[model samples]
Target chain A: MSTKTILCIEDDRFIGEMYIRSLKKAGYEIDWVVDGNDGLVAARNKSYDVILLDIMLPERHGTEILEALRGGKEDLIPKSYVIVLTNFQQDDQSRIAMEKYADAYLIKAEITPKKLISIIEKIQD
Target chain B: MEIKKGPQIASQFWPEFIKQKIVLIIVSQIIISIAVGCLIILSGFLAIGSIGFWLILGGFFVINLATELLIVISATRPTKDLLAAIINVSGEKSTLTPPNPNTKEYEKTGFRDALQKIYELSSVKDKQKTDESEKKDDNQELSIIEALNTTICGFITLDKNRQVIYANKPAPIHTNVDGIKIIDLLFNGNDTLDSWLDSCEEHSVHDEHVWTRIPDRLPNEEGRRFFDVIASYQKGSTAETVLTLIDRTKSYIVDEENLDFISFAAHELRGPITVIRGYLDVLGDELADVLVDDQSELFHRLVVSSNRLSGYIDNILNTSRYDRRHLKMNLAEDKISTIYDTISDDMKLRAGAQNRILNVDLPTKLPTVAADRASIGQVFGNLIDNAIKYSRDGGSVNVTAKQNGNFVDVSVTDNGIGMPESVVSQLFQKFYRSHRSRESVAGTGIGLYISKAIVESNGGTISVRSEDGKGSVFTVSLPIYSTVADKLLASNNSNVGLISEGNGWIKNHSMYRS
Candidate 1:
């Protein structure tokens, strides 16, 4: 088996660095982007096995990225599993919309780096 | 005051004396007597022959005496009758009887008319006094209603027939409410307003309801409107049903904007906390081997504090959602054991930090309950958090669950400072903390309120029993899933999310039907 690649789109610098360091230590090739625009560009540029997306960011939203990637009958990145990670509590309508496209939705405050690694490992399996 | 009273009495007495016909009779009698005396004196003074003068004087004297006697008899008879009639009428003895038809003198004298006029005038004055006071009262009531019109609250009074009997200036701003049924004023009228009026009438009590984005018939530039309607029914009053409407549109808009800001702030605050927690976990893991006893303990405390902060954020979010009535619950068959398993580690950690023992005992064959897993877990989390916070350092907190006839009862007991009965009664109210606890403990005071809301929304009941100096036990009972499955399935077949069954806050979402 080969090492899996993960893309983390988070706005906070500390959280982004933590994700990179933890995923790298866990033997995964991970790329981290700090804002929604850059994150969407990178996501479209290359296909990763798993994508961790944050909802609120500068210039764009994670929901918009999800819509661009997986709104149609065929996915833009076919085999990538999208996980929505956010601290913002969503209203019912947006939450239902996001749930339709995202594979897993997790609260950022509730999930640590170790738990994040396990979640990624499970998705890989 | 004494001088004024004397004049007032004199003023009243003169009018009454002049109104009597006896004054006219006395004046006429006086004139008749004076003329008779003059005639007799003149006849005696002009004696041309002694015998003739004497005869003339006697004739004059006899005629004058007879005339005077006749005048006295006629005048006294009518005056006496008039006096009797006046007394009879004034004393409330009987209605005035008209003078004899044969005696035309009575009408000629105008005595009867005078008496009738006097009686009518006095009675009319009495009636006018009463009417004046009543008018004053009416004016006062009118002024109150006029003042109310200047306020934001609109007032409308409805008769028993539902007609708009009275409406203030603000009341008719939305519709031409005059002479129309109150129910006809609103666009979605009959369903909510009609039933609310019926309830008020049936109970004869005051009630209130809210109407959101009402009156589709007339849309304005301000967009949607909200009204907090208060209604009351008064038996035997001019207005049977009184309706007061306070336009809450501005406040409603403010609340919505506030919720948005809260969501934004929560996201900002949580981002840093998440980072802090992540780094702390990383440090704790990386430094596991090198950290000594106190250092490890310090690291654990830091993690617990972060977790507590995270819990506080959740509480605030939940409270806001509850206030907005936007807390949508997805209730299904959930196991109590599963819920406890998810939260036990956190609960134990919190209690252990306080040097307290935490124990959870679930029966082997516990039944599944109809609940939302995440929300119910939060409920347990809040209860255990309270237990750990309120208890002494070395006390123990026990959580147990059992099946109780069509329901599962879960109880959390704490061997800590208990609450008085008075405090326990208000424990679940929003922002209610006992005075002592408020001074000593740090809390938002909405944890139990949110927990209760969540539990009841899931068709369960939550209660607390406490003894002041001893301890406290909080119990939650949720309906067994199998017992309510038939009803749930019926509701599902009907295409409603959940059959309210009395819980009216739940919104219908097709996805949550299962």
Candidate 2:
């Protein structure tokens, strides 16, 4: 089987590093982007099995990036599953991300890195 | 006032009423002329006969005076009827009519026509005067409304039918012209505006101002804008209002930012805590064979303390979420006993950790509740945790459940450091840690508040009963799934489910759908 790849777009450096460490340890190839703009560019460049996107980012919001990717004239990254990982747990943001075709909404502080990786593995299966 | 003035002028002004006087004068002159000529001719014949000539002259003079008086009296009678007709027309008592036809032909037709023309002119002048005053009043009212529109955040006036009669600058800024109903402009999409307004009408009280978040579709960019809506019904007036929205965006944004900061801070704190816990778990598992007895116990203590701190952080975040109305609930139909069973093991473990005995008694036939199972668990979990926290060493903390009428009443009774009546009343308030427990107990003081919010949002009530130096019983009463069905059956027992049929509540089938 081909190697499973994941993209983690998070602004928090430590959390992002922790996720990268845990997922790589779990034998999954992972790419991490710290800002929304770079994440958008990276998401368009290649397809991944899972893309963990954060709502709050440095340059642009994750919702806007998701909208640009999925709500465009052509589907920018149809093969990738977008999971919204955010510290902000507001209803409108959730609704917007879901409406823009996000596959899952998870609070970053609520779930552990191991559990997140296990979820990704389940999606792969 | 205008009608009275018209009649007053017609009565007091004598010259304007001369159409009748002119006719009387002409008829009296003709009668006098004919009488003088006849008398003169008759007296001349008497004088020629030379006997009783003086008596004949005297007789002619008396006959002439009598004819003149008769002519004057007849002319005055027609004039009085003409005056009565004029009074009637001016009083708006009847339509215009000519005087009784006792006078000459010119007096009948010509005098009546001239009089009618004069009356028409006067009536038109009165109408013009009234119109001018009304126009002035209208202009004054317009200026007042314009001033209000400029000074206030927004102003919208609806006519009795609730159609927009006037809307000011900020009105169009929020409520686009596409939204015709005033309710559309005022209500946030979280609730149905029509039903809310109908309730408002039914209550007949518009004294309260409701705070609503403006929908995102409107041109508010900074964040979600809020408006304070005040509605007043103007009975028998031009405007019957649904509501008026006053822009409260600035203060609302400040409040939102504060709440957001709390949520952000709580999440930031929890992130490191989770990582620490994650690493600790990995270490404990990896080194389980190598660690000694004391080290293992120390690690276990660390994990318990970390978990406790994590729970506190969660409480803070949940409190922030509840305050901002961002808490999402996934409601489902489940038996109350099932919820109790799910959390009873966890509650017992937590209580055992704190050196307390936790007892749970669940009735077998408890009805199902339409509630978010996880949220209800949290609510019950918080109450049990509080019971354990407050109880003395080895004290009994009883969690009991029973069916009470339409509700399932679950009570958490603790025999520990009981709070006073005053403290019990303030227990559920945000950030209200009790004075007695603050020194020894570690808590965020928001667990009870969050629990109350969760319970209430699930169509339940949470209340406490306590006495000074005695234990407290915190009871959560949730309305059962069949409660509405039972009420529906009782209110209209013969009709079954059709009572709320079109209103979307199917009696036995989906009354618990919400």
Candidate 3:
């Protein structure tokens, strides 16, 4: 079996670096982008097994990127599972909209590295 | 002297007798009859002829009869006319014939003129009284308007046509409200006021509605305004609808600005906490094999404290959201055990760090409850965290879940320092901290409040029973999924769960009182 690959789109430098270091140490190939625009570009260029998206990002919102990727009747990246991880709390309507498109929604402050790894493993299984 | 006194007394008596018209007439008749008798007797004594005596007596009798007729007419005619005039005036009929100027009947009797003057004076007096009463009513209305004007709240009275009948000073502060429609003056194409008025008219009852962030009509003014408006249908008042507007602009703006700042601060704080927690998790995992037991325990405590800090941030954010009525709940059928399983590991870590034993008891088969899983997890997390924080060293914290009829009850009991009845009574209030624990315990005092908010929003109830020097038990009961699923699903799209608007729960805290 090949190694699983993950793409993390987070704006904060410390949060982004923490995700990269932890997921790399957990034996997964991880690509980190600090802004929504580059993250979307990287996602379109090469498909990863899992995509971790953050809501509040520079250049564009994670929601806008999700819309561009999978807002149609069919998923743009059919195999990639999208998990929304963010500290930003969304209103009900926005949350309901995100829930429809994303595989899971997790609060960043509530998730530890081990927990995040276990959640990713579960999704992969 | 006696003769002189007799004449003086006779003069006084004659004038008095003359004043009495009926007596004078009767006396005159008697005198005339006496004169006739005297003449007859004298004629007889003088031995006059029988025919002459008879003739003189007949002539005296004729004069006597004529004088009696004159006396009867003079005595009764004026009285009859005066009585007829009185009846006419009392009956409100102007039927009394006007006195002829040529005949001068008014000048002759003077009674008709006197009655006319009395009638005129009385009618004038009645008119004056009515005018005075009307003036009093006007003054009363003016004073009421003046009183209404002194208040900071705006008041306006509208007729059935929605035209402004009366407006206080604050009501028309921005516009000239005379003859303007209420909708035009205060609202620009907003149907809420119109609908509220219509509802009041339909129900014939007083109804209240709130309008938030209403902009000023004046072009130069800045900032938004809030109003608590009431529309009432008064049965007998001159106006159709009485509108009372309490300007909540200042307090409302202050609350909004404060909430905004809180939200921003909480968001900023969340990022750093997330980073710290993530790095700590990474370090704990990487050093798991090399670290000794005590070192591992110390690391775990760090992780727990960081998690606690994150929880505090969430509480602050939730409290601010609750105050602004912006907290949204998406409820679904979820198992209580499933939610408990997600937070039990962290709960154990927290309890162990505090040197408290943690025990969780869940039935093998438990009913599903109507809940928002993530928020409900936060509630359990908050309760257990509180249990660990408040418990004495080496004490135990127990979490038990059971199936109550039509609901599931989860109780978190702690053998802690406990609290008095006074603190228990105010346990679920916002920003309330017991005096005993205020300095010793580190809390924002909104955990239970937000927990109550979350649980109640999911169609559940949360309560606590505590005794000083003993312990505390906080229980939350949620309805079974099957019972409330249909009702919740029907309104799920629009309903944002429990919302208490205004400063309602500040003093009363009635939401969780029972």
Each candidate structure's count of clashing pairs: 0, 0, 0
CAPRI class of candidate 2: incorrect
Q: What is the TM-score of chain A in candidate 2?
A: 0.91
Note the residue pairs that clash in candidate 2: none
Ranking by lDDT: 3, 1, 2
Per-residue alpha-carbon lDDT of candidate 2 for residues A1-125, written as tens digits (9 for 90 to 100)? 45789999988777787788777777879999999899999998988888999888999899889889987788788777777776666655446435346655666654667657755655444
Candidate 1's C-alpha runs over 4 A off are: B1-144, B147-263, B486-514
- Report the C-alpha lDDT of model 1 over B1-514, residue by residue, as the tens digit: 4454322332244335434544565555556655655665676664445675557655665676567656766756655455545555455443334344235665787665766665676688778989999999999998998798789877888887777777786664444446343432342313366777777678765455554433312322235455666667776678887877777767666644565576558667888898988998788789999998798888778888888887777777876676555676766677899877767777777788878898889886888888777778889989999998898889999999888898899999998899999899789866778998989898868799889988887888899999886889999999999998877666644223332211111223244323
Give all TM-scores, in the order shown: 0.63, 0.52, 0.62
| Docking quality level of the chain pair in candidate 1 | incorrect
**lDDT (CA) per prediction:** 0.73, 0.67, 0.74
* Predictions: Cα RMSD each: 13.6, 11.8, 12.3
Relative to the real complex, the DockQ score for model 1 comes to: 0.21
What's the C-alpha lDDT at position B476 in model 3? 96
Instruction: Report clash pairs, candidate 3.
Output: none
Alpha-carbon RMSD, candidate 2:
11.8
lDDT of 1 by residue, A1-125 (tens): 47998899988888889988888888989999888889989999999998999988888999999998888788898778787888776757676566567766788887889877877765555
**C-alpha DockQ of every model:** 0.21, 0.10, 0.32
Name the top TM-score candidate. 1
Best by lDDT: 3
Model 2 segments beyond 4 Å from truth? Answer: A1-3, A24-27, A91-94, A121-125, B1-264, B325-328, B334-349, B359-367, B438-444, B467-470, B481-514
